[model samples]
Target: MTKIECILRPGKLEDVKDSLNKYGIHGMTVTQVIGCGLQKGRKEVYRGTEYSINLLPKVKLEIVTKDEDVDEVVKIISQAARSGEIGDGKIFTYKIDNAIRIRTGETGEAAI
Candidate 1:
């Protein structure tokens, strides 16, 4: 199994989710996160005081899928999240040793 983690702009969440659903990928975990990368965040002025907002809001999407489906899933997410600009976010994948569905007691791919 493969676990795919995607960090994307908050505004792109709906697009990503809808694209994945069209591909029959319905199960996922979504989280609001704060992070900084190549974009390096930006500067803000509050009441004439300047400050660096180094951490920006982001949306983290986590999905566990069968090994063979990894490529397609990544492609779907990439296409949906792209904005042709910096701070578009990133995607990471990890090999999952096993997965278990607590309620049904299912394991491996079945569990996902």
Candidate 2:
């Protein structure tokens, strides 16, 4: 099993979600987040005052899937989130040791 986490510009969430659905990925966790990496955020002026916004709003998606689905999921998210500009965001994947469904008491692949 694997856990895929993607952080992208918030505006791309709907598109990414729709793509995931079209790809037959039904379950995921979505979170609104603030982060910075190479983009390092930006500067905005208000009332003639310049302010540096170090934390940019981003949409985070957490999906757990069988190992075979990792690459496809990543591809779907990358394609949907890309904008040919900076602050486009990033994706990370981790091996999942275990998973359980509380109501059904299912474990491993069945749980997910």
> What's the TM-score of each model vs. the native?
0.96, 0.93
lDDT of 2 by residue, 5-75 (tens): 99988999999999999999999999989988888758999999999999888989999999998998899
**Model 1 ranges with Cα > 4 A deviation:** none
Compared with the true structure, what per-residue lDDT tens digits does model 1 show for residues 3-106?
99999999999999999999999999999999999888689999999999999999999999999999999999999999999999999999999999999999
Off by over 4 Å in 2: none
Highest TM-score among the candidates is held by which one? 1
Report model 2's TM-score to 2 decimal places.
0.93
lDDT of 1 at 95: 97
